[model samples]
Target: MNVPAYAGPSSVTTRSGDALSLPAPRQDSEFSIERALHERRSVREFGKTALTQDEVSQLLWAAQGITSRDGLRTAPSAGALYPLELYLVVGMVRDLDPGVYRYAPAGHKLMKIIAGDQRHKLASAAHGQDCVADAAAVLVFTAVERRTTRKYGSRGVRYVHIETGHASQNVFLQATALDLGTVVVGAFEDDAVGKVLQLPEGEVPLYLMPLGRP
Candidate 1:
């Protein structure tokens, strides 16, 4: 498919330390939606191949990239609050230091949160799921309930979850298109995940997706 290119600012680190820029996401893809859907599977095993920076960019874009000048994302959000926040637990991505990076969707870049690979800890929090440690990277989806809760009240809780589902499905479809393997891991200890990622006080972990070459 013919997709538009991003003619925005180049990726740059805001400060010193491990913070680094990510490659711009490629808008075009030859992969067909029908084929991706047909091939999509909950893959638990992954090959040792390291994911490229472009693949990482594309996956993050699929999850929460801005699709228009107005900043509409690939996934739908309740009341357009966009409560979901994406984190990358890196292990084996090319040209990227292993660590936890937060996805800055507005900038289409990543901000380093914690340095060093934490895949093993994440796998432990995920109840010994090898995929968490084996995959090149794991996408951790979290949410700030107050962003939607204040607008929708208690029902906003459900909306945040639904939004996460939409984002997770986008990752699955994108992984399929890229010939990568991934699985949605929801059976993790919430507190453990929070501690491992050192999440902000208000954000809470909702879903974990481990992705790599199949």
Candidate 2:
């Protein structure tokens, strides 16, 4: 992965070329959990409007942002060995370049792994699901099983899957609250996805959630 760090004009670029400084996640909102749950549904069709930077920030925060001072994430991990990694496939987000970005939850920042719209390739990797390309952005979830397996034995695999469900659900409810449409797509060739993103070693792609306006 290319390491050229970047930052929006508003913030100074650090030595790591951290792409964008994410807006602080809102802690309170008028949207309630009950409503989000009731309205939540898989959205395959999306509008052409580009999503705002804040929206992108919120979704990443929901997925796996730091929620506490103790380093606990939004999702519970086995032995607190957070092994999940999030990648944002930006297609039509406002003030953001199109590219594959690695989410650094610690700084609430994104590091561009590569540039260009890889959504169509992702759609192809996902067996021609157009939604993969149509959406404004996709939040890709990957995991390092060894982080948990080292301590919990093979049962750690089960824990990681369970944590994925928790984290993805957070994405679902957060999208609903933000009035954004999204779907968790699991049907894809793992190796194909790995190749498309040129994922680093030991990072296994798990879920693909495309987000957009309905």
Candidate 3:
């Protein structure tokens, strides 16, 4: 849609920067959705090439962003109660700055939490996964329990994970199509990630996906 400039740190408007207008991929992509699914693998090793702002925008859009006029999302939700909140831990990217941002799916913007590189901390939190540091960006998915729990009670927890799976699959497919690499990390210090993202008490971290050049 729109591509907006990110005013660094003190001027950080939202989590992740606003989507910027950039060149779209060629008519032919590296992989189709079905092909991507067939070829998908957790690529822990990454090249030094950094992701561009447009790539980040496309990735977030594919994940859980709103796609419909009524704010309907790309990922399915239980009872249509969307409980997932996405965050971006940017380590290295070109044509933009780096920081920990919250992905505002509706506005397609980012709210910065902390500035500078913190992949080491994320790697440590993710059970010493070097990929967290090697990858250019790490996407953190959090769920606001009340959104679903109010309807499905404790069973809502399962739905949240299912919804996260949908969102993660979107990222994986998008990565494959864009010729990038991605890895999902389940082990992490939830409280620590929440601290890093400045999440509220009811918001719980669920999944972590790192993206980079393969």
- The top-ranked prediction according to TM-score is 2
Pick out the ten consecutive residues of candidate 3 with the lowest summed lDDT. 7-16
TM per candidate: 0.91, 0.92, 0.85
Runs of candidate 2 exceeding 4 Å displacement? 1-16
Ranking by lDDT: 2, 1, 3
> Candidate 1 residues 37-120, lDDT tens each?
999999989877777788898999999999989889999999888999999998877667788999888767788899888999
Q: Residue 214 in candidate 3 has what lDDT?
A: 81
**Sequence-dependent TM-score of model 1:** 0.91
Model 3 agreement with the true structure over 100-139: per-residue lDDT tens digits: 8777765667766777777888888788898888888899
Model 3 TM-score is: 0.85
